[model samples]
Target: MGGTWMQVLGLNWLVLSVTGSAATMGVVVMLQSLPVLLLGSWGGALADRLPAKPMLIAFQVLRALLAVVLLAGDSTWLIYAVALLSGVVGSFEGPVLGRFGSALVPKESLGSALALGSVLSSAGRIGGMALGGILVGITGPSALFAINAVSYLAVIGALSLMRTAEMRYLPTAAPADRGVAAGLRYVRSQPVVLIVLALSFVLGSLGRNYQVSMAAMVSGPLPAAPRRTASSPRSSP
Candidate 1:
């Protein structure tokens, strides 16, 4: 979670730095989410077929590698490419985490477990954002990327150390439930699930891009305040 937030902050800062155009930043942000729109259902189906532990580990490693790729160049195109790859990995990561998290506890404690997870996630995000801004200011955005790379190591270590024996694995989905179409069919059969999915899609796409919007605002109008602060000295003359 911390690493993901750092990547968010670093990626947005890098985009604005490279292009100096809010429009381009928006496009870059959209490109990062494009994979979720295109492959999220497929990814969820994959999580049902595969063991979540290994898949989650693999995706985290892939994400850390992608963070390393960011250090290879400063080109906007390179950033966009890495962003797209990160998004693809993220789509799979989400489902794996969700399925794995649910399996980690008893049915009676599931609600408490989920609530705790949300609290920790929110805390991680807040910490990562604050740390990211500080790191960027102190050592530039690359430092945040490097720190994010290291953060994944901690997650990988924790996951490796977890007791697999205690987990309550759901029975593997039947052959018919092993594809994107199967997931769609199941969702369609459950009206509540279908409605929740639709609402999430709508809200997620529209509301979750605050990093992009804020980045654009900061890069554009927000900096003007600092300039005005500087010009106050001139005005005093």
Candidate 2:
């Protein structure tokens, strides 16, 4: 997941560097997020019904495959499509990993376990971003994507080594059984939850476009000229 974020930043920077177009970067970023926004809940339901370990493995493989495909693809549309699909797969992977976290630790210690998990995740994100910037500076974004693909393989291997004997998939309770129209309807039935959901939607719709706003600002009202260095001259007697 950290690797995915690294790949995303590297890819965006690389594409923008090559195209010199902020609009393209915005489109790429939006495409990368669209699937998670659209399909994340469905992904969570699917995760509940499926085995977490295998689901994670499949998602990682899908991400790796997309990375390899992007390596071979030059078209922006191809990259966009791959990125969107990766997000969808990643949505499923997110909840699956969360469930796996529970299985990996004791029930009473779950809170501490999850806290440590989050700390490590944040560390990975920061480290991966720094490493990605260096990698992009030296080799290019495609190379970073390739490295991310391999990192996904390492994750798959780690998941495989985990014990799964007691880690059975918890059967999803049917919506009908819960006396709710659907998950959304159930959520909406609670006033606090409904308000939170509405606020989240509003924020996501407006706030998530900050990248576009930044790009526009940089290109429009606050354009900065590229810096150039002058050569030094020496005098001889």
Candidate 3:
């Protein structure tokens, strides 16, 4: 997750650097999320059909490969394409990892494991952003993308080292309770889920989407007082 965040921050900086256009940067960001909006349900369904361990390993590898692609060029089109591909990978990776982690512990310990995952997630985001900011300043966004690629390899290694005997696998979803339509129906039936989804949508759209603009400002017309900001003197006015 930290690596994911690092790549996220790095990609925005990369696009902004190459194009010098916040609107272009914004389009790349939007392309990443467009896949989630369009195929997220299908991703979750795919997760259910595949073995979580190998699926996660494959997802991690695919993400790593995408990061490597980002490292290869600064072409605006290449950046946009890789961003979209990363989003497609993440769409399935999110659900597969969630279910895979759940199976790692007994029902009694599941909540604690989830809480720990959440903690790691928060920590990863914070650390990744901070580190990415520093590294992108020092070595440029290409290095940052390389770091993320290696980080995914570490995840693949750890997943390989896990013990299959210890996992507490749950029964499969019934045929009647499967697919995108059924999932939507379940979400509609659960008021709490509906509310959470509504809030998430609102927060993502209104709050989180500002990163490109913020990055643009920090790296552009609204450059920071310090030289160590996302925009170097050479890149900024």
Best by lDDT: 3
lDDT of 3 by residue, 99-213 (tens): 8888888999888988998899899999999998898888878888888899987899999999877889777798767788889899999999989999999999888877776
Lowest-sum lDDT 10-residue window in model 2 = 228-237
What is the TM-score of each predicted model, taking all chains together?
Answer: 0.89, 0.79, 0.88
- Residue pairs with backbone overlap in model 2: none
Model 1 clash number: 0
Candidate that beats the other on TM-score, 1 or 3, i.e. the better one: 1
Model 1: per-residue Cα lDDT over 1-237, one tens digit each: 887788788876766566556677777777778998898888888888888898888988998898888887667777778878878987888888889998999989999998999999999899989988778766767888888898889989999999888898677778887789988787789999988988998898788878667866786768821222231221110
Q: Which stretches of candidate 3 lie over 4 Å from their true place?
A: 224-237
Q: Candidates ranked by TM-score, best first?
A: 1, 3, 2
Error of 1 at 191 (Å): 1.9
The better candidate by TM-score, 1 or 2, is 1
List the global CA lDDT of all models. 0.79, 0.70, 0.80
Model 2 Cα lDDT, one tens digit per residue, 1-237: 578767866666545544545677677777777787777777767666677778778877888898888788556667677767877776777777777777776677789988988898889888887888677767867888888888887888998998898664344677463332366676867899988888998998888776556555655577631111232111111
Off by over 4 Å in 1: 224-237
Per lDDT, what order, best first?
3, 1, 2
